[model samples]
Target: MDSSSLLKEYPLNPVVWDEMCVQNEVRAPYHKVYEFLKQISTEDLTRKEEMARRLFMNQGITFTVYSSGEGIEKIFPFDVIPRIITAAEWDFIERGIKQRLKALNLFLKDIYHNQFILKDGVVPIEMIYSCPHFLREMHQLNVPHDIYVHIAGIDIIRDADGEFYVLEDNLRTPSGVSYMLENREITKRIFPDLLPQNNVRTVMQYPQLLYKNNPNGLLGVAGLMSAYRKGNVAIVNAPGNGVADDKAVYIHVPAMIKYYLNEEPILKNVPTYQLNNPDEQAYVFENMARMVIKKTNESGGYGMLIGSAATEKEMEDFKVAITANPREFIAQPIISLSSAPCYLNGKLQPRRIDLRPFALCGPDGIEIVPGGLTRVALREGSLVVNSSQGGGSKDTWILSK
Candidate 1:
């Protein structure tokens, strides 16, 4: 391919891991996709992108954004190129998520009952007591099957060294599975032959997999608490799921895995600092610009500050907020997320991306659909990948081989 080809315009940064390329050579997993793109004209690729948008609109594949109590509906943005993953990589991710979920479920059961981890000082008692999501009412309450997290969306990102790290665990009513399914359908409409040629595994079975564990007749929406107490209705994400959702509690997941399962973590967590600690707070304050500060109990990309992207005034204001309620915040050094080629404005550009593989924990065991929602930071040099933050998504292809 010449320098003007779609593949050539994508500039690889030495510090950022490129998913499809390494030093101008295409990676093995993305070799087919890279060759296919080289044969397509830029105009043809642009048309495919446009076709994806139209299909999304027609199919009502969208999410609503709420601002100032008003909800604004917008079509979910999708990139034309699909993100591809090798079989080995998918196996690694699948095993890691299942192991993490097992530990988290065990932690929830222990936290609300025996408090063994707390007594053993694996996790602090004060941290649990101060967390808003720690439900006192759930203490000692029995749940069916001992499964606290049924559906989990684990946010994972590849760092500069191309190593996968768990960003956070979303145990409370995790969304975006629909987006994962829809992205695949859109890709089928846009690139009909590519999927079969690549031997990409199917994510179409996700809905059926979920139905396999569906609750048997539902009680009336009213008196849910009463029904739940009597075991008449089992919640999908059992009550007190938010306890695991707390970012403060997230700092202890690796330890939880070892404590409950007696195994070291298969997936590592991003190095997180607890702002409630005096020494850690002092360190974060001094190097604020190199970190990303987040509210412990908040989600949807809200209540966060990317210190590197913040203005001086914004950083100062965030510091004041962190000081006032140190327990509500945690900080991590900004990760240089992996990037993939994306077709933008008739040119291929590199965009940062993350993967959120949906894991379904059922009575039988955990089943992770091979492919996932590959969320991309569409804007140039942007790091945030939440849809609410101007992010787009592309279909993820998990090769069968």
Candidate 2:
């Protein structure tokens, strides 16, 4: 379909010509990108797929996928349509995310030391006692920089009305920031014109931004000191964070925050009841078919039981497991994740997806990179967006023009 016909079917508002005229008055760095995309035909985008493939090959960017055999290396998929972020929008998001992270770090610290929030009833003491993520081992271990969360991924999504909402926070081992940098590079090379005509800022320097506060800053440091410095940083998954990120560990975060931070958490966790709570555990045992039970330490969509999908026998097994060791499990209502348009099989289709925007906390403050990784659940109606599954990704554009 032509752009006009597609717009008619989709029922989107027309671009305001007056705004375009005003935007044109400024000598935007992305003017070349805007002009280029306007002239290219859809056929050009198809041809550019080859350019994207070659770019991935040249850059040696690849991910390992485990299948029947295991350990298969493949290039990360790339899409040509770059997600744009306007400066104004980015500024707002940056501020909100920074505030959220700062609060969360303080909460984590408090959870390990004191029980202030819990005592204040901001978070119930029972709730933390039940969380699997609450690590007694980490109770007094001081983080080197006094920063529990050096990196975080805050997910946000725009509803049909186009207002953004926080979906979830991945405080530990958040991946896919690498893809954001690679995707922009590929989009710029493949369809240089698709960039917004206004003064669209590039997230190209994001890695640098993430690495900027390394004890050495930008001046290349050498050898052991760089290695030994407590703040010496790299983007590899958070060190020793998996313990707390585990679903079981999550049960403890509220307690940890209360114990360590002494302040109430601004955001609320989804209503989750641990199997260890006698009344809640009894309730879950009775209504095993209406909730979602998850193993505390498993990830990548594994060890998850959707009560509705379970047979009587499976439900029985889950009940027995929970009854035997309530601390090993937690249950919550199954969340209906949102969806977005994604390119699949040469056509645009609605797919379940989630966002994971990276946040870096440094000496100055927290900085959330604009345009996070948009992960799509490739299966028709699936909600699991893990790359380990048959999921794919798209470029998230926070448009400046």
Candidate 3:
């Protein structure tokens, strides 16, 4: 089938923005990809996808899912269609992440030392003391360069209007970067000259950038924890970062940007409501169906409830849990995440996706290699994109000027 036929088969959600198509016309960044697809038959695309999958299988690129005290290894899903971002979009994302990190690093330094943000009544002192991740031993302990967040994988999502919002910051051992690099390599094999033809920027520099800063490079090595205790190796992301990346602390990040960096945040945070507040809790309880309730310390799509998708039992269970320990929960409005086209079952389909771009901070500066891991909700009409929750991934392309 022609690209027009493929485009016609792919349905767009009127309420959700599409990355590749706007009113059935392919967007500028996807022009080259669209043209390439125009000449390929549907069978050809399926073959390419199959080839990509086999390569992943052969290469043993997989993630483990734990269940019943056992680990199940599964191949990480790879979609043929790449999620393309323009040069302008990438620049905005890079700048925003850098700005946020600067503030976060400063916040960590301040919190562990003077606790100025808390003392000045900026962030509630109770919030810090109550946080499970806050270590009392870290108080007044000086780290190298006083930098806590060295490497970051900040999760960013686009809303219905195509506006970017940071969903969360992962300052501690952020995962999925290997998949990002491998996706690009796999694309190079499947798409051949398409990447260069589209002027896509390379993500291969990620490893080099990482090693450049970590001369010791002892992460993931056996006895690394013992070495860390002896101060024999430096942790890229220092301890006590949980005090900064805590979901409860996320609400105060904009204030941190203004307080520490002396500038407004370039990217907006998704409007979040702390369930501990009486007013916010009342509002969320009243509009439970339109909110997503999550535990402050949870990750991997666990300990969360999607209100719209939750059953009566799930909602009631969450209500009881939140009421028991109000500080452990927060809620946000259900954002209609932007969708992108995916190749599945020999046809183009729309799926919700989110991006997690890795940013490396060294003594010199912060550098974000172009492109990231584009996680997709493979299920129809789902919003959650965690791999443990049956989500897949797409190659992200950041085009050059």
Candidate 4:
């Protein structure tokens, strides 16, 4: 069988965009990859994927997933197929994300300083004040180079329309670039022939993109913040940025961009409803089965309720929780996140996935490593892609054109 026939054997979800092959047509950026894979045997391909998993585990590239009372450290799942983005597509994504982050950084500074946006009514003042990550102590404090968002993991997801939307902003200590770099390394070993002869545009800035393993978690947050304030060391993501990414605060980011940059957002936010609004709350509560509810401050895919997957008891419990503290929650129509082919269970399977590109805002400016982490929902038909939520990582490739 040819490449087309082999790949088409796996059914593509009708509602999601396939990153590699679309309706029997290989996308331009993935054309080379399709040809390359055509010559490889399925058994050999399976072997390589298994090898990749072992390599990740041996390198200690893992995240702990807790269940009941146990913390289990498992090697993050790796998909051998590269998710390719064309040069033009990447240019749009790169520019749009940099713009969004700039707007968010300005918003953070403004919120911490004069509260201009709030005073102007571009964003509700109560939204900021109610945010759990909003820190009053950072008011008037200066971040080195005036860049509050040193590192950001801006999650991008494609809906059924194949348009990318900024799913969420990871402003405070965004993890996963480690996996990005690791994925590239493993790819190097797995596809040495293709990468060497052709200089595929990969995440080349390794030194700057990778984050130090934070063994201490929040215990280190205080020390890092103090040193940051003192100018002793510039933290990658300046402290107190969590407020900007708070789910409730995220909905207003486009407004922040408009207010601060005076430019329309290049990337649109997923339509979100702040539970604090009585009308929005009523709508969300009435349509609980069609919405995905999340706590404004939650991360690592925690504190989320997938309406389609939730049990009735869980919905009742979550509805009561949201009702009890409406300001703490936000809801969005469950988006059909794009899918990618993953080598799992000894076969190529379609898995829901999202893109998280890491942005480094240094003294110079924002420099994004070509492709970031492509997190996959390892389970069948799942949307949650955090590694902690049984998700996996894939090497993302930005074609050289």
Q: In candidate 2, what are the lDDT values of residues 1-401, reduced to their tens digit? A: 24443212321222211111122231243345335444556566567866787888889877776655689777776655433445665676676566666666766665676756667776566656656566676665555555667778876654333345554567766778888778777777765655554444566767787667444432334663345344454422223444445565455554544455555543334557778779998888788788889877665556678787789999899888888977778887655555544445544444656667888787677777768887777787676777777776767666654
lDDT (tens digit, per residue) of candidate 4 on 1-401: 15666676778877788887688777766666777778888888888888898898889987887754699888788889877777888898999899998898888888899998989888998888877778888999987667888778899998899888999998887888788889999999988887654457868675634343211223355567676667666655666788888898889888888888999999999999988789998898889899999988788888999998999999999989988999888999999998887777666788898999988776566888888999999899889998888888888887676
Ranking by lDDT: 1, 3, 4, 2
Q: Name the runs in model 4 displaced over 4 angstroms.
A: 1-4, 196-199, 208-232
Model 1 segments more than 4 A misplaced: 1-4, 217-220
Q: Once model 2 is optimally superposed onto the true structure by TM-score, how far is the C-alpha of residue 85 displaced, in angstroms?
A: 5.9
Q: Better model by lDDT, 3 or 4?
A: 3
Whole-model lDDT, model 2: 0.61
List, residue by residue over 227-324, the lDDT tens digit for candidate 3. Answer: 76566777777877888878988999999999987898999999999999999999999999999998998888988999999998989999999999
TM-score of each: 0.97, 0.72, 0.97, 0.93
TM-score of candidate 2 versus the correct structure, residues matched by position: 0.72
Candidate 3 residue runs with Cα over 4 Å from true position: 217-232
Residue 322's lDDT in candidate 1:
92
The candidate, 1 or 3, that scores higher on TM-score is 1
- What is the descending TM-score order? 1, 3, 4, 2
Q: Candidate 4, after superposition: displacement of residue 281 in Å?
A: 0.9
Candidate 2 vs candidate 3: which has greater lDDT?
A: 3
